[model samples]
Target: MADLASLQSGPLRDLPYRVAWRARGVHAGAHRGTSSGAGGLFRDLATLLEAPDPRRLDLRASLRDPFEQLYVRRFERSTAITIYALIDVSASMGFVGNMRKLEVAAAICAALSFSARRIGDRFGVIGCDREIVPELHLPAARARAGAVVAALRTFRPTRRGAGGLVDAAAQIAGRRKLVLLISDFQIAADELAAVFEALAAHDTVPIQLIDSAEAASLPRFGLLPLADLETGRRRLVVLRPSLHAAWQRERAEHEALLASLAARYARPPFRIVDRLDWDRLAAHLMEARG
Candidate 1:
């Protein structure tokens, strides 16, 4: 498990974070944007009729033209992206394997916040339990890494309900943002559907944190006591080979459904087990941009 103290110790932490969706903000930053702006990266070249900026004129190309048609360079805008770590601090996220899921969530939040700051983007964190935790909702700002880590350290997954995600989504409704929703996603499909609809306005990345044993490879010979992590309900059942097979099949079906839902929103879900894999996440973001 990554210690919080160590996680926040680096102020210069960087990640190759690329915005997968088009950014709408006008402020200059490091991510690609749809609107063209001054001092932006090269996008393409266009004919004089399309782009009339004399300052961007390609003199060599104009000289080489047989028809003497002028050409101009075009550049894409790089703008600031607001990155919100909408973390699920419900009881389900407290499950432990090598480390608690909540710890993994904290690590992810810390890393993301630090990386966002490194790139001059605004970073914020929202802790969602029974509802969006009022004290844990930090509005996006630059250079708040220390405060964000402190807020993360105060989170405890003690909530027993499953309807907080919709509330969390509503908090970010009016603005375009890059939201990283860290959760186990144990809620009912109907509830999740509602949350998905509420988050349709932003570029949402669902980070599904799972315990290793819960995801796969359970022992099939013993009596296992299974408990609803959120509802405080428990049951004891003999884990026979046939029952184990059925469990595996059910898990596969659920994952398939999640993939389908993410595809519908044009955001593929990323999964991490027992620990937050920062490299994997950074690589996923890089590939997403392409």
Candidate 2:
């Protein structure tokens, strides 16, 4: 895992994102909004009486009117939206493999913060374990990336569960937001489902952190020592060919379940293995239809 200084020095790329729904915020920004305003994508022509903006009068439309009613062009306004990184900071996130899960998560938040600010959008972070970590809470604002990076540097995943995600969902109830739900997703199926249900109103993107060393790159036969990060239980087992295959199968099943659940209420889960690939992440964000 890279230290804070190294992480800061790394180049942060702008993450391209899009939303299927129209934004409702009044602030001028990049995303398409429901409001009709002075400059944006042309929506439709309305009678001058309805739009009341003579400056946008359409001469051709007015000439074609039977009643000779004046017409004005209406455009869809671009409005600002809040982007949040809803991170799962459970004990399992502390696991170190080919790459540190928590470190990758922090890098993601920092990139998002930078991207959002660059595009005139508000960015925030909400970290959860057994409960919401107050120190990791950042309200939606056009804040600097340094602030986000600094805050994440202090976060330590010591708690056990991610139940606080549901609570954090409730806190961001009012407006539709772009939520990047980052986690290894080592949680009960029912709990994960519930969290998705709570955040259904928002455009949620589930980013599943993965480390191949955890299961994929295991030796075919060896004495394997494993410890449950959440439960603090240690076990030693003989890793046979059959057991290895079974382990991979179980992991695949779990991923399948998560994908099915995400498809129901959000976009398909984006898997980040080993480390964060900026270009791949940008492509996913751009192409994801949520």
What are the TM-scores, per candidate, against the unseen true structure? 0.80, 0.91
Q: Write the per-residue lDDT of candidate 1 for residues 18-48, one digit (tens) a residue.
A: 7666777878888788888567788887788
Candidate 1 CA-lDDT value:
0.75
Writing each residue's lDDT as its tens digit, candidate 2 over 160-246 gives 888999999999998899999999998877888889999999999999988777746778899989889898889999999999999
RMSD of each: 3.6, 2.3
lDDT of 2 at 218: 79
Worst-scoring 10-residue span by lDDT in model 2: 1-10
Q: Which parts of model 1 have CA positions greater than 4 angstroms off?
A: 1-12, 42-74, 215-222, 238-246
lDDT, candidates in the order shown: 0.75, 0.85
Model 2 compared with the native: what TM-score? 0.91
- CA deviation > 4 Å runs, candidate 2: 1-6, 217-223, 238-246, 288-290
Query: Model 2, 252: alpha-carbon shift in Å?
Result: 2.4
